[model samples]
Target: MALSKFGFIVTGAGFEPAGKRVVLSSEAFEMIAVGVPAPADALVVARQLASEGVQLLELCGGFGPVWTAKVIEAVGPGVPVGSVGYGPESIDVMHALFKA
Candidate 1:
C-alpha cells in the first residue's frame, strides 16, 4: 500500500503511551527536518527488530537524496520498506528510484 500522512505519525516521539494526552519530546522537534540517510546504525537496528519479529519496516521518505537507494541496498533485495509521504512528488521520486 502507498504511504499516507497518518502513517508518518511516530508514537515514541514523546509521551510513553500512558493512555492519555501525547506529549512531544524536545528532541522530536530536533529530528523534525533532519535527513535520515539510511544510517549504518539503522542496519543494526533493523536487524535487531527483525530478529524480534518485526514484520514491517517504515523508512522516512523525507529528502535525503540517496536514502531510498541505500535502504533498497541495505534491506538486501527481498525485504519491503515503506516510505512515508502522501505527496505526488514523493510518489514520483519513489517510483523513479525504486523502479529504476
Candidate 2:
C-alpha cells in the first residue's frame, strides 16, 4: 500500500511530546513529528500515533535498539517501525554531543 501518513519521534532534553508535535499535510501525504524528553516517553507517543492511523513510525537515533524494539512492540504488528542509526565514524561525535 502507498504510504500516505507517517510519524517521526525525536528525543531531546526538555521536550514535551504534546506541546512539541507538528503536523505537515498535503493532498498526497501527511507527516507528524513529535519530540519527547526521553526515549521511554516515545512508547506512549508511538502507540498513540499508530492508533491514530499513522502507517509507519520512525524514531531518532537517540532511542537506539532497545527503545525501538519497545515502540515496535507497543504498536503491535500492523504499523512498521524504524529508527535512525549513526555509523561508526560518528560514534565519537555522537557521544560528545549526547554526553551527560
Candidate 3:
C-alpha cells in the first residue's frame, strides 16, 4: 500500500500481556506500526493517531460494529473511519453475502 499516512487500531497479540502499547518504526524502511489492546486502548489510540494527522483510520478486523462505532466516536467526525472487513471497500463481499 502506498499510503503516506495510515493508522490501524489493533487489539490482542501473541506478546506477553495482551494490553501493552506496541510501537514499531523503521527509519530506513519508512514503516511504522502502532498496536493497542482492546476496549480502553482503542479510544486512546484513536485520539493519538488523529493527533498524528492520519488521513485514514482503519479498525482491526476483530472490531465489530459496536466497537467500530466507539472508535469512530472517539476519533470524532473529522477523519474518515473504516475497518478491515465489511466496510465500504468490502461492499462486493457484503453484497455477495447479502444476496446469498
Distance from true position, residue 55, model 3, in Å? 0.9
What residue pairs clash in candidate 3, if any at all?
Answer: none
Candidate 3 per-residue C-alpha lDDT over 1-100 given as tens digits, one digit per residue, 9 for 90 to 100: 4555666666665422233444444552222245665555677777877887776788767687888888889989887888776558887875785473
Clashing pairs in 1: none
Candidate 3 — number of clashing residue pairs? 0
lDDT to native, each model: 0.41, 0.91, 0.67
lDDT of 1 by residue, 1-100 (tens): 4321111112222323221122223532311111223344355444443444334556554424365456556656445555655677567766786663
Instruction: List CA RMSD, all candidates.
Output: 11.9, 1.3, 6.6
Model 3 alpha-carbon drift over 4 Å, by segment: 1-3, 14-32, 86-100
Candidate achieving the largest TM-score: 2
Q: Kindly give the stretch of ten consecutive residues in candidate 1 with the minimal lDDT sum.
A: 3-12
Error of 2 at 7 (Å): 0.4
TM-score of every candidate relative to the true structure: 0.39, 0.92, 0.62
On TM-score, the stronger of 2 and 3 is 2
Answer with 1 or 2, whichever has the higher lDDT. 2
lDDT of 1: 0.41
Q: Rank the candidates by lDDT, best first.
A: 2, 3, 1
